[model samples]
Target: MITYSNLGKKGNLGNQLFQIASTIGIAEKNQQEYCFPFWEYSEYFEFQFKECSSVENWTSLREKAFNYYDWEVSHGNFDLNGWLQSERYFSQSINKNLFQFKSDFEIGLLDKYHYLFARKTILVTVRRGDFVNNPNYFQLSYKFYLTALLHQFNNLQEYNIIFTSDSISYCKKHFSFLPNVFFLENLKPIEQLCLGSKFDHYIVSNSTFSWWMAWLGEKKETKIIRPMKIFDGEYSKKNDESDYFPKRWIEHNENEFKLENRYWKLKVYGYFYALQSKIQYDLKRQKKIIKNKIKDIIGYK
Candidate 1:
């Protein structure tokens, strides 16, 4: 069975995407042995690490499995691309397309149910890519976004901002502005039930879970807010829409927040990539230096 760990180095949602893609890919291969979640554990890696060591040998193997997303299937044990090219992956993509057809399917589902619901429905999603490699990065990051959003939309109404986050405990602890906002552990189940009805507007962090939710939501004229920059910096409306909004909703970056990697995984990866580039550059420089020294020593052109 194929298993994944810290998919994209993020939590549940990240892992879910990887699982969906991999499941489709493996199913295409007609290899019944290929199964996702051979074991289902809820705790994060650190929490689960000490308790579960039975599958320790599969760590490197799983990384090789996900590399197929980038088409780098050079892993000796398996042909990742071949698996992705299989019928299942393409079929899954097609299913998603059809599923998205609801965006144009008459009156929006949100209006149907949540239009006059006493509690205001605010779609909340958090992004912590910078914190994916860091510990509790999303925790701190979510608090920042949650507070900012509440303050920005303070006068909206007596609202209930239904938040979706991967970190349940963090949400429970930080977001206690009762009668105002609440947190849902994950949006996957919400996405399933909300085939028609969902949030009125989406206040999304730099996270893919919210991006897809807002995209899939059947709300017309929903206010979709995102961070000014993906992890940092800034972006134009077009880029933001293309990157975050999958449907006709407006994509606006109302806030700009710094990228915080509480665990420093992002920083670590950045340094890793930068170091690799510098090493290559230095190697070339050294080669040039050696060639010049040889020419000078031999007195040749």
Candidate 2:
């Protein structure tokens, strides 16, 4: 039997789904009976695997397994931890079966937004909550989004840009001026995931939540734009260590391109760049202050 403990690990909805998907992938590959022990947050998602089962004694089994084998070597041997994120190990067929929305509310929301799916839609996932406040995480500038949008769609007026985010207010405050921009608010995490998967194209933020959403719906025709850096200045140098970004997706780097012999256009581009930098700096500071206040209020050390 193949089983893993899902206790005491504080993870977002995306990571939890990935864990379950990884287990399903491993079980199919190894032809083992897979079981995922329930955690507090398991009820938030609906997962089903024909050969998989759940048990209450997940913690006890996990402890016994750890005591019997070297934790690092044994865990890595099965390729359990990295399978979901790695392109080499990921099985789309298995994952598609594992993650499904069980709630009627979530399924209804997907149907409500079916009109967007029928049209030429570009899903833009902007992660704000903890990513903006945390220095360790990579937060892409609005300029990156602009660059990617301009690169992908020469005529932005033709397609609908659907913005889904943790902070809808933040998206509206910054991106409301853009043409064809629309926001979907007050959605459950699973609902957001389902909605995002239906889009024709994706402009994803440097967060695992956005990554999973893009991965779920990826197709031969699908175009995905991802940030080149996944962390701040010094930390971003280590991006080569992980196989997070798929080969087919476009990676948008932060470097400025020089416009040759177009003096007027160069000046205009420089002005926009300067303005974007200032706005990004201010937003980062504000988010950090807000995060600190919340942490203090919650007495989180």
- The per-residue C-alpha lDDT of model 2 at residue 216 equals 77
Which candidate wins on lDDT? 2
lDDT of 2 by residue, 1-301 (tens): 5554552253776766656665555555665556655555455456643322544443222222111122222222232333244444445575565555566755687779766665578888888766763566776655567667777666888888898888787677656767888898887776787777768889999877898888877878888988875676655564342566776888876456432353455446546764775688788788989999999999998
The candidate 2 region of ten consecutive residues with least summed lDDT is: 61-70
- Expressed as tens digits, the lDDT of each residue in 58-105 for candidate 1 is 424333331233322232222122112112243343344422323433
Residue pairs whose backbone atoms clash in candidate 1: 109-196, 133-265, 134-263, 134-264, 135-263
For residue 291, give model 2's deviation from the true position in Å: 15
Alpha-carbon error at 131 in model 1, in Å? Answer: 3.5
TM-score of each: 0.40, 0.70
Distance (Å) between predicted and true CA of 63, model 1?
A: 18
Give candidate 1's TM-score. Answer: 0.40
Superpose all Cα atoms of candidate 1 onto the true structure and report the RMSD in Å to 1 decimal.
14.9
